[model samples]
Target: MTVEYAPGRLADLYGEPSRPTVLLWHGTQTDSRAAVRVLAESIAELGVGVIAADWDSHAADHGRADLLASVRFAQRTTAGAELVLVGWSLGGVTAAGLTLHAHAFGVTIAHTVCLGGAFMAEDPITGGPVLADIPASAFRAPFTLLVGTADDVIPVGAAEDFAAGLRRHDWPVEIVEVVADHGSIAGARYDAATDRYEPDDSAGTAVTARAVATHIVAVARHA
Candidate 1:
C-alpha cells in the first residue's frame, strides 16, 4: 500500500502492522517501492511488515532530510511495534547511520540488515566521510549484511570489511552470501523506458529470490 505521511513523499508498506515492522530503504537513483517490492512482499509473506520509502538521494538536500522525515513517519505510525531497519546499497549506509543515531529520532531499532551496502564511504550530503569506523558502543542492535557473491556493483569484500570493522568493536554481525548479482537478488532489471526496475520471473530468479528470502526470514527470527 501507499503511505503519504509526508506531502509529496510516498512509501510502500507491505503486510500487516501487527507483525514485526521492517522499514526498507532503497539504493541511490532507484525508487524504494519498485526496487524492494519483490523482497518486501516475500518478507511480508513470512508474516513481517515491510515499509519501502521513496527518497531521492541526489536531491538538493541529498535526500537526508527526506529520509529523516520517512523515519519519523515510520516511528509514529508503527508506535510500540518492533521495528527493524533494512536498506540496500546507499540506503544501507543510511540505515546504518540511523541505527547508530536512533536515539536522536526517539526510536529504538530492534535490528539492522544491509544488502549490498556501501559503508565507510564518503557522504555526499555532508561532504565528508560516513560510517568510517564507527564505535561499537554507538550501535545498540545487531547487524546482518547480505551480499551476492557475483555482485559487480559492490564487491563482496566490502561486506567483509564492514563486518570486520564491526567485529573489532565487539558488535554482533552476520554476513550471508547469495548466488546472484546485485539486481538479481531482488529479481529486478532496469526498465529504460520509465527509468525504473521491472521484476524478472525466470527460473533462476525464482530460486535466488527464495534463497534470499529464506536467509532474511532466518535473520528476522533471530532478531
Candidate 2:
C-alpha cells in the first residue's frame, strides 16, 4: 500500500540510522516523548536507532485509527529500511495490528515484539471478546511477546494464550518471561528515597532494550 506522507513530527534516531531502525510504540496512558527517550537512550547504548511515533492518546478510543496512522507514519519515515516494531501494553495490540497492515501493504518488518501486551480482549469465559483478532497471515514476520512472572495487572496465562494463538496461525512466535512485576516491564521503579517513581536501573532490564534491539537486528539481518 502507498504510504500517504504526513510531515512535521520528530523522529528520535539513534545509532547508525543508516542501518535498519526500530520503531517504538509506547503503552496507553503514556506519551511518546518520554517513553521513546528512555528506551532509545538505552538501546542507543548498544548502537541502534529508534523512531518513536507519537499518536493521539485518543487512540484508546479509536485504536484502529491510531494503528493505521502509526504504521503509515512508520512506513513513510523508515521507507526502504528494515523496521522492528515494539509495542507495550495497549501499544502492543497496536503493534500487532500494524504488522498485519504492513504485511498486507508489502512492507517488511524485521521483527515484532510486544511487551506485557494487552492482546487478549477479555476473559473469553467471562463473556468478553478474545484479545487477538488478527489472522496468521497478517503476522508474516517473526514475533516475540514478553510478560512478567509477577504481573498483577496482566495475567501471565493470558499472555501465554496469546502466544498459543499465534502459533496456531503458523506464525513464528517466541514468548519470554521476566522475573519482575508489571512495573518492571516498563522498567519503572519506586524510589522510596524520592517517594516517586524513578527509572529502575533494573526495570525492563530483564528484557533489556539491548536484548530487544538485538533480536530485531537479527531478524533484519536474516531478512
Predicted model with the maximum lDDT: 1
Error of 1 at 211 (Å): 2.2
Which run of 10 residues does model 1 get worst, by summed lDDT?
Answer: 122-131
Residue 223, candidate 1: alpha-carbon lDDT: 68
Stretches > 4 Å off in candidate 2:
1-11, 59-63, 122-139, 189-223
Q: What is the TM-score of each predicted model, taking all chains together?
A: 0.88, 0.73
Model 2 per-residue lDDT tens digits across residues 99-205: 65565555677787777777765321112333345544564687788787777767877668877877777778788876656545655544558443334455455
**Per-model lDDT:** 0.75, 0.60
lDDT per residue for candidate 1 within 1-223, as digits (tens), equals 8978589899988888733578888877745567767787778887777788988887877788778887788877777565788887888778777776666566677888888887765443343455554544574688888898888888888888878877777778889888878777765556779776566666787777677677766766766
Clashes of 2: 5
Clashing pairs in 1: none
Give the lDDT of residue 195 in candidate 1: 70
